[model samples]
Target chain A: MLNVKDVKKDFPVLKNRDVVYLDNAATTLTPDSVIQSLKNYYQNLGTSVHRGIYQLANETTEKYERARKKVADFVGSDSPREIVFTKNCTEGINIIAYSLHHWPEMEGKILVTEMDHHSNILPWRFMANGSEKFQLEYVDVTKEGRLDLEDYKSKLSPDTVAVGVPGISNVVGTVNPIKEMTDLAHERDALVVMDGAQWLPHRKFDISEYKVDFLTFSAHKMLGPTGLGVLYGKEDLLCRMPPPFGGGEMVLKVDRRKVKWNDPPQKFEPGTPPIAQIIAFGASVDYLNELGISEVNEHVDRLAQRAVNKLSEIPYVDIYGPKEGESRGGLVSFNVEGVHPHDLATALDSLDNIAIRAGLHCAQPLHEVMELNSSARASFYVYNAPEDVDRFIDAIKEAKKILGGADER
Target chain B: MKDKPEIYNQDVVHHYQNPHNKGKLSDPDFSVTEENPKCGDRVTLQIKLDGAEISEVKFHGHGCVLSIGAASILTQMIQGLNVREALELTFDDLVENMGNPAKMRKDCASLSLNALKKALSGW
Candidate 1:
């Protein structure tokens, strides 16, 4: 069993208030170790990497590159050179979409699922709309909010260039079988792009075993600092794709008439990176490693299992996600009989300081498929405990009374 | 009952629960639907006009308390007003009519007004 109380102490925000933050899908609370790492980076040796040869600059460069290696190790990638630093997961998706025009092998349809976040969908939508050759299609979601495998097969054809899928749906919390999906796409000679932003933090990720062509995740969602993202691509594919941006460090040599772009990872990173955040992210990887990803995954699953089971017992509560006994990532999106999701979130915030997400959750198409305008979502991370879910349920009952209850159905 | 937040006062709650003219007109001169894409709140406003004067106005849709209350309050405000007068009802007027709402929710409180404005333009 994971020690919840001991784990809570690492996060200063959890210690200071009565805040039961259940919005981990948006961002996780940074731990003290990660914060300390950031302060140490700025207070001791604050300098841009690859810019100087002074003693402090050398140390800074070493730490920054070490952070890259740490992130690469954390994700089971053989080489740090395959990892490209970005602003967030959204930018990572954009990088692939923008660079796709340069690859002639990817001449077919871009098959994405309806369950993908707007970050995953909009870039492809823009790419498809801008180009006459690229055709974009969606894999339908099942009634249970799982991706319809049959629909995915139907969309997969010889012309399919890439299949963009979420490791888990942020709204519905469906834990997709990404390895199987990746294998299926690979059989069709289509690349797979996994939006790991929502799913990576909750489980043990091994890209080596999963063999996904590209995986993108935000550092902020995984107890690391904000303004930092990781895009892991296969060495061969990355070498072929065009750099999304052009600037100083990204080029081997630049002249008025001719220029040569730098190597794979460096080519992708153009400007001064988020050095402090990247250094701090290395500490977060250490922190999570100490706790063990399997333990974190189990702890979160237990909370979600308890939350879903208990919330379902309430007559008025309608939980939207996988059925009980099915595997789901740790999150519960639901609606009470009459209270609006926003109003319910506010009501909970008023009483218990229980923060949650209440909106389209950037999966508008999935919400439309579910016929919900909006729904309240409670997501958990390693810091969250079962007690938080209990308070959430009680607060929801209180919300129903104040909002005049949902229709009796 | 717990004291409501300023954004969810008794007036807003009452209007949300018991919205005014909440069903669509059978046959109307103008109708339109406005949606807040971020929150997925939507309202379709139907108006039955009498030439330059407005004979009836009703709204039917689903949204948060702020939006539903705004729609309810808007129908009451524009029922007797002319088409030009209804169009003149600005976003600020709706905020003033109801208690001030949070900055993030301004669109929620103005959904019906936007629909009403669009409907009046078609008229």
Candidate 2:
């Protein structure tokens, strides 16, 4: 069992603040090891990577690339060459969409689900926009906020070129059957792109097991530094696909008329990369490895289930996502009757300084389909405990009383 | 403003539950809808002018306690006031009429005023 008290000690924010932070779905708290690694990089080795000839530059480059290998190993990829660093998860998805938009063979429809964040949706929308050869389609989401597999099977035609699905809904907390979906999409000869932003933090994901053509996630959401994201693509697929953006270090030979791209990972990562963030991410991976992803996931699931059970008992509270005891991510999205999400969020804050996300959570299409104006979400992390959940439940009742929840029966 | 649960303030709850001048004006002289992109709350403010003054003013659409309550309170305040004077009524002025929570989320509190300004910017 993962000890919450020990994990909480690693996070300075938890020790410093008396606030209950339940917004882990948005971003996880940075731990001391990751922060120390960042400070070490800036304090000692302040040189750029993949360029300079001196020992300091070469040493920094070694550390930077070693971080990539650690991340690759953490995700169970045999080769670090498959991992490409980008600005964030959004940029990684955009890179794939950009590369596919330029591919001559990419045609017909680009499919995405209603649960996808704007990061996954807008890139495809921008790709399909004003293009005759390409079209955008949305897989239906059931009333329970679950992905409609029947709708997905119906839409997975031969003409479907790609499917961008979330491994877990950021808002609804629905843990998707990504392996099954990937297997099905592969049968149709369609490329599957999984948004792993929510999955990576709470679960163990082996690329070979899922066999997704592309997986994109942010390191910041997994106790790593911000401004760094990873794009894991199949070796052959990365080799075949073209890099959309071009700059320094991405190309080996720049001809007078044409340029020869370097390789898969480097070609995708143009210009100077986020050196400090990448180095710190390696420490984050080490941190997770020490805790063990399975134990962390199980601990989170227990707390989330506890939250679901307690919330279900409240007559005025409505919860979204997978039902109690069903598989879900580390968050719970809910709404208080007759109280707007913003009002409820504010009331919670005023009641006990409980920090929760209160808005669309960047899945506006999902909210629109669900017929909700906005919703409040309480997300959990490694540091969050059962007591935190109880405090949250108590705060909800108090907040409801002041917010005039429902019509008082 | 931060310490108190402003949305549940007796005045805000009363205004939100029983909004004043919430219906549409027929053959309205000016009508505009403004949205708080931050939280996705919307407010549509409609007005009928008699000479230089706002003869009738009403607000409609979906929003939270601050936005809806502020719109309800502001419409009642704007009645019979000169159109230019209504435009002069700043967010702070509206908060003074209502409560101080409006100052915290000024965008939501000023949504109705933003619509009114958009509808009358041509003048």
Candidate 3:
């Protein structure tokens, strides 16, 4: 029941006559409201916060705090104190990585999935290095892109500190059952961190209801400005975890020798934050809230299903991940026969200005597990419609013809 | 030139469709495989030499139009050149040969050039 026409109007980039963007999974186009909010921030109240006692700094600080509350409310967290701002999702993961390294009770193994993005995988690997006490194990995924629960169950042990899993895959668009996976990990006395980078913009997710220990996502993926990310941790756990960085604005008092870090959200934010981007992120959340998340999910699901069906009809195209609409998200990954993913993407772009992602999508382990070096991915969002799918399919067919057909192989 | 296709043209498409000098040159003086892995582009280069004068050059692999075209063109370009001359082929030359491809497609088009350099490195 989502109106693509109305949604398309919100993004000025859609007006480009030749461009048909299908690379939403990489990053979405910012809405007009978010862009306006960003412009307003710089034009009107551009000042350093928490330092000056002037009216401009005070107003900026209040607006920044308000943006934090908006992000917390969007994810169904009770208080804004739980939301910590970072550079991007990669920094958010690193924050947790550094915090776990400092934990007194940190011991044993960390459970992760082979399907995790490099952002989720490398930080833990870097933290576990030279520590004989810590081990890292990955849960294997099935060929259909579903997590093998049996494999996950076998890896769960008493010494597991946390299980980091992606809510939705960047490459395959497989939606993991975070609640179920977290519940299983909890039974084994392990904390859970959900990488919601691909999940937050497309679907409705309630952090309170899910009761996940921590969740992280980049704002740029959700139609906001770049260089901003969100990390939502339970208040109690966040208060106990040490801050990854220490500098101005994060400390309550600084002595000659020692310094006392501020409480939960503020401690994690070090140095000058990306104030304008955060303000724009708040506008993006407001825009998404207006278009209900459920409706957005429904729209994306329809587009993805339509794309999968139409692309399947083309001979020599092999799709990855779940076939059922409910099991997958708004993305479809595939490789065309007799063509490299880069070639297919390039051909498609030339023929019809259709932009699709082609690569390992920063999930090298997932590709290694699937035995594929790269894949062509087309992901959808609220602005995408059935007509977009038709055009995308037509572009692919044209690419095949221009590349001398699949029969040429 | 502005009216030409962005990165796909008749010549590039034809090379991708029916690439010349494809497949390995058995018992050749030099051979190598280069891959981008990000875009799943793979290329294997095989070169045969007759006392510093190129005797035969061939390539076999899987990749996109730019990559395939570059490999096909590379085989044709390096046929009579010495190993040092073959090593001089840069990404710019590859893009120039394809009517100056988009900046994004440069990596794909340069695969064959990189493979030739890799093959020469072993020699």
Candidate 4:
């Protein structure tokens, strides 16, 4: 298990006396190492990469490539050639959507899950609207928030091009069986893209073991700076797919009449990149590696289980997602009877300075399927502790008193 | 103004705990549903009219404290007003009624006010 005290010290935000942050699913707190790396980049080695021949540019280029390799190793990709840096997870998914225009035959029938984040759902839906050959089929999820594999099996057809799903759900904290899903999709000759935005920071993942065609995640959600994302596709596939955006650094040569694009990863990464943020992201990954993902995952699982057990004891609290804590990460989405999620969130905030997310969490289809308009979610990261969970539970008890009793139900 | 606790301000928790005139009015003169998908704040308003005057108003549904409180206070505020006057009510009026608007509270307060206006349209 990770030394929770040491892990907490890495994040400076924990020093704030009045803030109990339980919103890791929205974004994680950056560690000092990552923050310092960003500062060092700006202070000393600040220059554009790939385009310059000067000493500073060469140093910047080497650091940028090293960062890419670090990300490649972190995700277990075969080579750094497959790693394409984008602005964020949303943009990464959009690249896949834009590539769908090149494959018209498979556009009409794309398969996605109801539990997907809006970033995963909307891009394909937009493509469907723009092309007659494009349409979307959705797989149902179980009441406990696990993917209904039987439903997914039925939804996969010969016409399906790809199945976009999440590695971990932002709302429910359900860790999907992505390897099985990807294997099933590959058997049907369809590609699979895993949204790892909620998964990467909390646990260690190997992309090669899953053999997914593409993987996407954001740095901000992983304790790095915002506006940076990593998109990993197999080198062969990346070479076949054209760049979605075009500008400097992404082209080999350009004339008024024609332009030749760079290789797989560089072709996709255009414009001046978020250099400091990417370097900082590498630092965050290093920090996570040092802590060890196995320890981090176990710590998070223990915290979630403890929270579930404690929250379940509260008279009318309705915790959603898998009942087994082992099947979930360090997040719990719940609602107290007779109290709306927003009211519960506000009450908790007022009572204990506890911060939690209260909303549909951009998973509208999932909420609609579950017959819930919204929910209150408390998500955890390495920096969170058992005391945080205790405070959260106590706040919920106080909220119950503030919003009246369970008798209203 | 009554030395209200910061957490128990007339604007903060009152409408959520004891909402005013909540529920549907069958065969009401005006009705509408307002929603803010971002925060999952939803409200359904039903108003009764006697000629141009709103005789009664009620709201029902689920939302944050700010939203529920605003809806409750709105029913109390608009009960005796004319349909035109209620229609003229902006989100600012609702925020003002709830004391002062915080940066984030404005959206929740406005959602109920917008629902009220939409409900008043056909009346």
Model 1 CA lDDT for position A195: 96
Model 2 agreement with the true structure over B4-66: per-residue lDDT tens digits: 444456787788878899989888899899987657898999999999999999889988888
Model 4 chain A poorest ten-residue lDDT run: A400-409
- TM-score for predicted model 3 compared with the true structure: 0.94
Estimate, for each residue in A54-74, the C-alpha lDDT of model 4 and write its tens digit: 999899888888989999999
DockQ of 4: 0.43
Q: Can you give the lDDT of residue A56 in candidate 1?
A: 93
Q: What's the lDDT for candidate 3?
A: 0.86
Tens-digit lDDT track of model 4 for B61-103: 8776778888898889898898788878877677778875345
lDDT tens digits, residue span A19-106, model 3: 7789998899988999999999999999977788999999999989899999999999989999999999989989997798788888
In the order shown, the candidates' DockQ scores are 0.45, 0.48, 0.48, 0.43
Listed per model in order, the count of residue pairs whose N, CA or C atoms clash below 3 Å is: 3, 0, 1, 3
| Leading candidate by TM-score | 2
- Model 4 residue A26 lDDT score: 91
Interface RMSD of each: 3.9, 4.3, 4.3, 5.7
**A344 Cα displacement, candidate 2 (Å):** 0.8
Runs in model 2 deviating more than 4 A are A406-409, B1-9, B102-104
lDDT of 2: 0.90
Worst 10 residues of 2 chain A by lDDT: A400-409
Off by over 4 Å in 1: A406-409, B1-7, B26-29, B48-52, B82-92, B100-104, B119-123
Query: Which prediction has the highest lDDT against the true structure?
Result: 2
